[model samples]
Target: MIETLAKLVSTKIKTGVTQKELGARINMKQPQIAKIERMHTLPSFSTLTRYAAALDLSIKMTVESIIK
Candidate 1:
């Protein structure tokens, strides 16, 4: 889930939004979000929920697929 979210984050970055701004939208600390995207850390379920919401994706179903 973090990996897919990171891909979207890369898209957001290319579109000119900073990590700080992206983190703000998802209510995460910038460094926390950064670590997840860099694959240095895994995000919690709630955090992934927030990220999925922020990224306009289906959290439950999609992640079940990912986990499987």
Candidate 2:
């Protein structure tokens, strides 16, 4: 799930924004953003929310019932 979210963020960043630009928006370093985009490090929930907000996006989560 995290990997998927990372991929989505990466793709959106590539669309019209650079990593450095995004980092600045989120008060993070470019390398750190790169690490997150590449999935080298998993971003904390707070960081994820910040990232999404930086891109004017939102994060949504869904839960599935295995018992079903």
Candidate with maximal lDDT:
2
The deviation in Å at residue 2 for candidate 2 is 3.7
Off by over 4 Å in 1: 62-68
Candidate 2: lDDT over CA atoms? 0.80
Compose the digit string of candidate 2's lDDT tens values, residues 1-68.
57656665776657788889889999999999889877798888888888888877777778899995
How does model 1 fare in lDDT? 0.73
Please give the CA lDDT of all the candidate structures: 0.73, 0.80
Worst 10 residues of 2 by lDDT: 4-13
Instruction: Return the top candidate by TM-score.
Output: 2
How much does candidate 2 score in TM-score?
0.78
TM-scores, each model vs. reference: 0.62, 0.78
